[model samples]
Target: MGAPRILVVDDNKDMAQGVAMVLREAPAEVESAYTADEACARLGERAFDLVVTDVRMPGQDGMQLLDVIVERWPRSKVVMLTAYGTVQSAVEAMKRGACDYVTKPFNNEELLLVVKRALRERQLEEDLQRLQAEFEGRYVFEGLVGRDAQMLGVFDAVRKVAPSHATVLVCGEHGTGKELVARAIHRLSGRKGPFVAFSAAALPDTLIDAELFGARKGAFTGADHDRKGHFVEANDGTLFIDEVGSMPPLVQVKLLRVLQEREVLPVGSSTPTKTDARVVAATNTDLLRATREGRFRDDLYYRLSVVRVALPPLRDRIEDVPLLAEHFLSRRCSERGIAKKRLSHRATRVLLLHEWPGNVRELMNVIDRAVLFCQDDVVEPKHISFDEEATAADLSEPQSYEATKREVLERFQRLFVERLLHECDGNITEAARRAGLTRAAVHRMLKRLGIAAPHPEARRG
Candidate 1:
């Protein structure tokens, strides 16, 4: 909420002040510490977003400060400053958890750029931590999974408004877990009645009103007996209307009346019955745009959206893919009474790179299929497939067997190296170590595959 707080540590007073002055021009609050002990004292007093410390300071040097900062304030980003001859030391600092390093005698603009980058990274890490906390049961909401900042924001909104009686409009792309959110809201709403769900798209336009509001006996062709509707069934609780944007315009007017008057008027009945059902409606389409096009009632949209919750598409929160996949695997395995299957590293890499146009639903189906087809304990890339049309198109290709084989191998090699580099933070030495290969061999592979390390700052021996 405030300017990122930064601590500048250098033994030279003038140097620290000059660096602080340069950083002050940026969006930061800079504090000076002449020694590692002083910096430690300052850190103990308050948490900083980023710390800039010289590599060679009096007594405990920057490396020591780096280690202490890494241990004490793991979320804070540290940038090491060093002379040309000690670049290796700066790289060592990076291994010790420093984000990036800077050579001494740098200009204001260069320093500001690195500082800004570090702060941005700090914010991302913080968001990730918050997300992890939410995933680990800090929030009482259930059936929803994600630690992305956007998802956490949704959780915060749900927590704030679930206790109230305000109507909620859950908007997102299809299969983004809008219904899960609605169920969570109801579960946490402290309501006594059941959580009733109705799919507006599945219901016929002729019967939607009768489904939402009770119909008296002999009211319609199929109405042989009096029937209670979702509003009454969900009385004193939540009524989740899925794909609500598909409701016919005529039904929209009746829904708006229920919201306005807190009463449901049955079809073919003159009397209106009072009801207390909290409405939580979801739609994948742009209801506001639908209103502009006269397909939906604008007044009803406003009424249902008194408290809106928008779910983030899977693509926007790729970091949560592993967790979601694992969750699905365990749940499905338990359901089928089969042993749990794990995702191979290569399979997970492919999942991470995929463009999930169908959002979470597509991912779930992919995992489900992979589990069923995978004979081994681990699900591999060959076992995972999506888009039947794409599969058919590929099958119809007339390429020679050799050409197809070469292409597939090359693609697999590229993906493998890229994922390793990413996991190792683009440090070729670390990647090589993890892959059990020589650094020179890894470089050769990268060159052959036409791949370059993405993080230049992370390059190390």
Candidate 2:
């Protein structure tokens, strides 16, 4: 909560003092060291939030100092001060883990801006780590595991809204754990009745109504006896409706009435039964667009979205991959009653590098599969397998610096574009807006990389 503690290192005492003075304006606890050895001693004595060092220090220069900091205090961020001609060296420092760099005779505003950004990022990372440490058990909030800023926000929202009877709408891509969140809310709702779930997309149009709102004997072609619908069965409890965007027009009308009147009229029955079931609807598609296209009712959409919760995709929160992967691996091993399996360093690196298009669900599946396939206790690169697409790079072999850089950049571009399209649901304009790129530029890049959008509509635009 207080100003960040900073350490300024330079062999020249005057230069170190001058830089320290400028940083002190931010009201930080600034300390100076005249040599790398002195700086290392100070770091050992106590932790500093940020370390600013001149690139050309006598006896163990900035690069060496960076290495020591990275190995000894990985959490602390570093900023390099470079002479004009050594900009490349500063960039090298960044590649090695420095947060940022500024040239000598720096502008105070620019320096402060970089420092603020680095500090903010570090704070977010630390907060996420704390959350993860606290929620290491499988159930952070009813069998959900996440430590990213976005997921933490989702957890907070669920906690704040669980006690209320407000209709909730959970929105995310497929396999992003919308149902899990719904379950968490229900568990926290203090409702004694059973939790019931129905998927709108999995049922036939003719059966949708009958299944949702009970059917009396002989109501339809094969109705043998009276049946209780989700609304009636979940009375005094919670009802989760999955893939609500796919509900039929008639069903939408009936559901809207249920949300409004809190009652259901079973098929072949004139009498309506009062129900106190709390409704939670989930969708992977955009209900607003569905309404615009006349596929869904606008009033129903608004009624369901009283408290909307949007879950982040895996790509957006790559930082949580390691934690989730380890949890899955350990759980699977325990279920099998086998010795614990662990990922090799190489395997961990590969897992971190790949883009998880299928989200947390896909990552879990991969970990389980890897554990099963590995002959030894250690899950190596060979044991791991991804989807049919050859998106993962072959890290078994070494490559030139240029080749590795090019490959990494291309993969990142492809993944970023794919996620953008998915988030926008094939709407090119929306994707462009979110990506801050013109439509033509994205199209050109996609074409050049031979990357196709998952939604065909994006390709057309």
Top model by TM-score, which number?
2
Give candidate 1's whole-model lDDT: 0.86
Q: In angstroms, give how far residue 313 of model 1 lies from its true place.
A: 1.4
Candidate 1 global TM-score: 0.56
lDDT of 1 at 349: 62
**What overall lDDT goes with each candidate model?**
0.86, 0.86
Q: How many pairs collide in each candidate, listed in order?
A: 0, 0
The count of backbone overlaps in candidate 2 is 0
Instruction: Please report, as a residue range, the 10-residue window in candidate 2 with the lowest summed lDDT.
Output: 398-407
Off by over 4 Å in 1: 1-135, 138-141, 389-461
For candidate 2, write residues 349-456 as lDDT tens digits: 667667788999999888988988997989887888887545466786755534544565676677778777778777777888887889888788878889764566
**Distance (Å) between predicted and true CA of 77, model 2?**
40
Name the lDDT value of residue 343 in candidate 1.
81
Deviation from truth (RMSD, Å), model 2 = 15.4
List model 1 lDDT by residue over 1-461, tens digit each.
78989999999999999999999888689999999999999999998999999988779999899999999888789998877537577668778999998997888888889999888888887888788666668532477877777888999999898999999999999889998899989988999999999999877776999999989988889999888899999999999999999998889989999999999999889999989999999999999999999999899999999999999888767667777888888788889899889986667666765668899999999999988998888987788898752431233334543454455557657877988987887888988999889999999999899897455754543
